[model samples]
Target: MGDVLRRRRPSRAVAPLRRDPRASGRFQRSHRRLDLRQGCVGRRAALLRWALAEMQRAFLGVDCGTQSTKVVLRDPATAAVIAVGRAPHELIERDDGTREQDPAWWIDALRGAVRDAVRGERFDIGGIGVAGQQHGLVCLDRGDRPVRAAKLWNDTTTARECADLTRKLGGDRRVLELTGNLLLPGYTAPKIAWLASHEPEAYARTVRMCLPHDYLNLWLTGEFLTEAGDASGTAYFDVRARRWCEAVLAAIDATRDWTRALPRLAPPLSVVGMLRREAAESLGLEAGIPVSAGGGDNMCAAIGCDLVVEGPAAVSLGTSGTVFAYRAEPAVDPLGEAAAFCDSTGGWLPLAATLNCTSATEWVRELFAMDHAEVDAAMASGGAAGLAFLPYLSGERTPNRPEAAGVFVGVRPSHGRDAIVRAVVEGVTFGLAYALDALRRAGVAPTEVTLIGGGSASDAWAQLCADVFDLPVARPAIVEAAASGAARQAQWAVEQTRPSLAPVTSRRFEPRPRRDLREAADRMAALREMAGANRL
Candidate 1:
C-alpha cells in the first residue's frame, strides 16, 4: 500500500497559499492539473483585482458544522470580515453510536445565519462558498430531496459495514490501494452500505448519496456536485488519482451503478453553479451569484490559515479534533493510520482525526454543571497529578475503535470538577498529540502548528496545545477560519485570482522548555489501548 505513494514521496512543487498575489502567486507545476492559482498577469493587475474585490462585491461563506451553521461575510479585496452570524443545530445523538441531523435543519440554519450576517442590508453579493463537516452520508430521492436524516462524521455505527466492505475488497491492503486510505466507520461509504443493509426501504428509494456540503450545494444551485477535497473523505474516492474508486462502489453495491448517482467532481477555484433564485431569496443574497467548489472543514481551514505551502501543521479543535499538514505531494501513512486526503488548493492533505474534542469537553461541562468560564478555569487548574482522560465520547477514530467510550483514569479522592476538567483537556490534547506523531511518521514535520476552531478561543487550551504538541501554537485572528476560507474560495472562483490575505494572529504560544508529558501521553496511550480492546 505504501509503495503506491512511496514512488512519489520525495518531490512536490506548488506555490504557497497567498496573502498577496503580488508577493507570490498560486503556482503548481506538478503532474496534477486544475491549479486554482494559475493565470497571473502582474503585480499591478493582481492589486487591481484586490481593490475591485473589496469595493465591488461582498463574499459569503457558509459553514455547516456538527453543532452549528456559521455564516461569515467578507470584503474579499481587503480580506476584512464584514459580518458574522451563527445558528445552532440539534443533533440526533444516540447511545448506539448514531449521530444524525435532518437535512432541512442545515438549510434552515443557513437561512437564519445568513439573514443574521447580512442584517437585511442586501449588499452586492459576488459569490458564496460552503464548508461542511465531511464524510456524512446524505441520501436523496429522485427529486433530489433527502430520504433520511444525514449521518454525521462523528457517527460510529457503521463498523460492520466498513469491515464487510474491506473484507469483500480483499482486506486492508487492497482497500487502501483502491481508496488511498483505510475504511473508517465514520466515512460515508460505510454509512451508505449500512443504509442498504439496515434501512433497505430507504436505501431502495435513495437514488443518490451526497455529502453534507454537496447537499447544501444542491439546495443552493439545484446541481449535484462535489470537489476533490470533500470527496476524498467518502471512502469511494481515489485520493491519489482524484477520481471515484469504481472498486469501492462495486463493493458497496454490485447491483447498482453508484457512480451514476454521485455528484460531478468540480475543479478547485471553479464555480459549481450559480445560486438559484429560491436559495438566493432564502439566503438574502442576489440571484445568479457564483458558488465556489468549497471543501471539507479542515480543507477550508487549511486555506483560512494559509497552510498551503507546508510550513507548519494545523490542529483544528472542533467538535472532532484533527491534526493535518499540507503537502505538495501525497502524505501517505503506510500503516493506514492517517488519512491521505486531497486539499482544496490542488495539493494533498495528510490528516489524522479524533472523534472527540469539544464534544468531550461539553459533555464534561454538562456532567459537572459548569459554564464556559468554569471550563476555562478548570483548564487553568492543571495541578491534578497522575490523571489522564481518554476522550472517546463519540467512539475512537484514529485508533479505529468504534465501540470505545470515554473514561477518566487515575482519579484520586481529592479530584474535583476542576481537576477532572483539567484532565479532560489534557486527554483531548493527548489524543491530538497522538495524531501528530502519526503525521510525523508520514513525513509531516513542522516547527509549529496553527490553532483554529472554538477550542482556540480559550487561552488555557492554547497553552495546553503548545505543551502537548511541544511546538509553537498560534491562533489566527480569524475566529471562523473554515467560513472565512469558504468566502475566500468564493472570491477566487469569481475573480480567478488569489486574494491578498494574511494571517492576522493575536498571539503565539511557545511550548515551555521540557514541559515533559511523555509519561502522561504514554499513560493515555495505554488507557486507549485497553479501552479500545475492551479491557479497561
Candidate 2:
C-alpha cells in the first residue's frame, strides 16, 4: 500500500515471469516460486525487486444467528467484502414452547462456513471477530462440552421461571432498576433459573454459563470471556455499572455463585484472546491471530452503520424487529420499554425490540398459502383501508405481553387477500414505530433510521418504515451489517486504525406519513393495553 511495496519496471535485459495455463489460475513452480533456503534468500529478494506487489490483507467476521451462521472476508484497505459464506442451523422446536439448537451445530456451521468462503481465495487473514445473537444460553460442563441444547431467544418455556425470579427480586420496576431491563423469557438469566427448576440434573452439570458469542470465542481462543454489549442482555448485568448485578443473580439462584460460573467480562474494544491452534486448523486460520471482543448483533450493527455517535438510529428487520440508538450515557427507561443496553464503543445503546417482523409476515403468507412474490405484489396494492392488525401471531417482547396474540380490527367481509397482506406488513411496521417511540421517550431523537437485514430487501417494507416512523429510512449498500461490524472491530483492534468509510445510503425512502398510520398505531396500543390476553 506504499511506494516501498510497489513493483518497479523491469530492465530491458530481464525477462518477465511466464504463466502456465494448466496451473488452474494459480502460480506454478517455474512461473513464480520463492525458495526460503539460506542460499536462495538473496536471489529471492533480488527477483522480487521489480515484478510482484504485496497482496492485500483481510479479516474474517462471523455472525452466528439463530437460524444460520454467516462468514465474510472483508478487505479493510478497500472497505469491501471480498467473499461470503453461509450455513444454516436446524431449529429444534417442541410443543411446550421449547426452542433450541445443539451447540455442536453452531461449531460445525462456523467451520464449514470458513471453508466455503476461502475455498479458492488467496489472501492473508489478519484477525477474526464474531457477532452473535444475544440472550441465548449455552451451558457447558467441566470438560468444556455443551450440557444441553442452547435455549433460543424465542423460547417461552422459561416464562414461569422469569416471573418467579422477578417476584423474588421485586416487581417489574424494581427488576428494571437492578438489570436495566426486564427479566423476560428471552434473556439468559431466566434460562438459568428454568434449568435449575425443571432440569436439575443439567443445572448441576452446567459449570459454565455463556452467551452464544462467548462460547464461540472460547472455542476460537480457548478463553472464556464476554463483552459488555452482549452481557447486557443477560438480565443480570447492570448497564450503568457495566458489570454483573449480584442481587439479580442471587434472585435467580441463591445457592450458586454466578460470578464464578459466568464468563469474565472483557473490555468492549479490546482483544480478549488469540486464536488457538486447534480452532485455527479447523477454520483454516493462523494460530495466535488476534480475535476482537465483538459485541451483540445490534451493537455490531451500530458500528457497521456508523451509529457510534448519537445521531441516527438503526432498525434491523429480520426474524424480529429492533431499533437501537447510541448515547453517551445509559438511557434507562423506567417502564422498561427500551432496554438500556451498552454498546461496544463504551457508550449506551437504548434499544426497543419487537419479537415479530418478517416472521409475522411469514406466518400470514403460510396461512394464505402464498409465496414471497405474491406477498410483495399484494403489499404494492392499496393499503388495508380501515383494517389494522396486531401482527402478534407469537407473543411480543416490546409490550411485555408474552400472552398476546394476533388481532385484526375493522376487517370486513369484502377484505381480500391483498388487503390481508397489507394489514400484516403494516402491522409489523407499526409495531416498530411504537418501539422507536420508546427510544424517543428515553431521550434518543435520531435524525433518520438506517434499515438493515433481510426485510430491508423489500421495497414495500422500506417505504412502510419511512411512512410509519415519519423519518427518512436509508438502506446501506452492505447487507451483512453485523458481520461487517465484527470485521471492522477486529481491524481496529489489531491496526489501532480504521478506514474513513462512513455509511452511505444506496437507497433512501423519504417520509410520506399517512394519517391512517397514526390511527392504526393507536388502535394497536389500545388493543395491547385493553385486551393483551383476550380476543374481546
Candidate 3:
C-alpha cells in the first residue's frame, strides 16, 4: 500500500465528467440488430438499452444511514445533484442498552431508493459509491449470511468489554499508541470482544466482520473490502499506518485465524470491484459498472463540504453530532476524545462525535406533539432564562461517558412549553460546542463551521449554533452532502483524479451579542462530575 501511494501522483485538478454524444444514439441503433418479432430478442434488447442508457449520464451515491437509506444521482461535470430518493428503516431499541438493525433491510432499502431515484430517467450511471454509518458490527457466517442483527455505534452494551480490552492492552495510553484511539463502546473492536464472550456460538460462526458500508459493498460487488476512514473507527486499525493493528487484534483475543475475517484494506478512491450481475439487475444499472471503496459518512461529508484544507471545519447533525477538521497529516489526540481518522481523499480527519444530536430534538418534538414549524416558532419565542437540559439521552462519546442519561435541571412551574423546547435545542447545540472545543484542543482552529444535516434546515438552530460556538455558521446549498460526497468519490475512483468541489454556501448565520453561557456550561460540568462519581 505504501508503494502504491509512493507511485501515485497527487493531482489537485478535479476529474472532468466524460461525455459521449453519439454513445446513446449508437446504443439505440444496436437494438435494431435484434429482431423485434421474437419475444426473447425483444426482452434482451430492452435490457441492453437500459444498460447502455445508464452509461451516459452521471455517477450514483448511496448513503445507508441509521434511520434511512438515501440515494442521489449527480451530474459528474458540475458535481450537482440530479435526483434524490430515500427510504426509512426501523431501529430496534431495547431497554438494556441495545441498538440493532437487520442487514437485510439495508439491501431492500438500497434497491428501493435507487429505483425511486432513477424513475423516469434514461441516463447511464458512470460509477457507484456508498457512504454508510461507521462502527457498526456486521458479522457474517461462512455462507455469507448475517449471524445476527448488527449492533450499531450507539449501542452501549459493550462498556465492560471496552474496559477489559483496555486493561488487556496494558492501559489507555498504550492502546492509543497502538490504534490511535481509546477503546470506546461505540468502536468495532469492543463489540467483537463482547460477542466473543457473551455469544460464543455466534462468534464461532462468524467468518467475516464488516462495517455497514463494507457490507453494502459486498452486496454490490461480491467483494469484502474497506477504506481507511471507516476502518479507523474500528479500534483495530492503525490510523497513521493505514492498516489493521495486529497488537490491538491480539489484545481483543482474536487469534491469527480470526484475523482472516477482517476485510482487505483499499484506497478510498480506488475501484474495489465491478458491480455484480444480480445486484446490477436489482438496481437497474449495468453489471460491469465500477464500484468505489467509499469511506464513512463523515469523511464523505468533508468532501461534499469541500473541507479538504486545514482551516475549514464542518458540523454534521444527524443521528450523531460531529465536529471535524481536515489535516495534511495524522493528528492524534492525547486524551483520545477527538478521533484520528483518515480522510476519503488520502488526507487526515480529526473529529469529535457526540451520540445524541437531532435524535434529542426528535424526542422533544414527539413529546410536545409539535410539527417542525411549530418547534421553530417555539424557539423563536423562548428565552434562555428558564432551565438547562443535558442532551445525553443515548449517553455521550466525546466526554467518554457511556452510562449517562438525559437530565433537565431547574425546571419550575413558571417555565412554559416554549422554554422546555428551547432548552432541548440549546442542550444539543451545547453538545456540539463541547465537540468543537475538543477539536480546538487537538490544535485545529477553524475560521468558521459549515453546518450540514437535518437539523441545519432550521433557521433557529443555525443561529443558535453560531451563537453558542462563537463562530460564523454557514449551510451548504447541497442538502445531501454525504450522498454528494459519495458520488464525487465514485467519480474519483473511476477517473483516478480529484475534483475541485468548492462549497457553495446558501446562507450564513453570523454570531450576535449574547450573554455568557457560563451558567449552562457549569451545569454541564456538574453533571459530568456526578456521572463520574457514579460510574457504572
- Identify the runs in model 2 with alpha carbons over 4 angstroms from their true place: 1-54, 533-536
After superposition on all CA atoms, what RMSD does each candidate show versus the true structure?
12.2, 8.2, 7.8
Off by over 4 Å in 3: 1-56, 254-259, 516-518
Of candidates 3 and 1, the better by TM-score: 3
RMSD of 3: 7.8
lDDT of 1 by residue, 1-536 (tens): 12321232221111122344444233333211232333444444455445445443578888999889999888876787888988788899889999999998888888777767766454567789999999999998989889999999988899999899999999999988887799999988999899999999999999988999999999999888899999999999999999999989988898997667899999988998988888765555657878999999899988888888877999988888999999998777887889999999899999999998898888889999999998998778664477788888778998788888778788889877788888888888888998998898778998798998888999999998998788999888885899998998998888999855777888999987533377787788799779866896
Query: Per-residue CA lDDT of candidate 3, range 458-486, in tens?
Result: 99889888888889999999958888889
> Who wins the lDDT comparison?
3
Q: Could you tell me which 10 consecutive residues in candidate 1 have the lowest summed lDDT?
A: 8-17
lDDT (Cα atoms) of all candidates against the true structure: 0.84, 0.83, 0.85
Pairs of residues clashing in candidate 1: 19-501
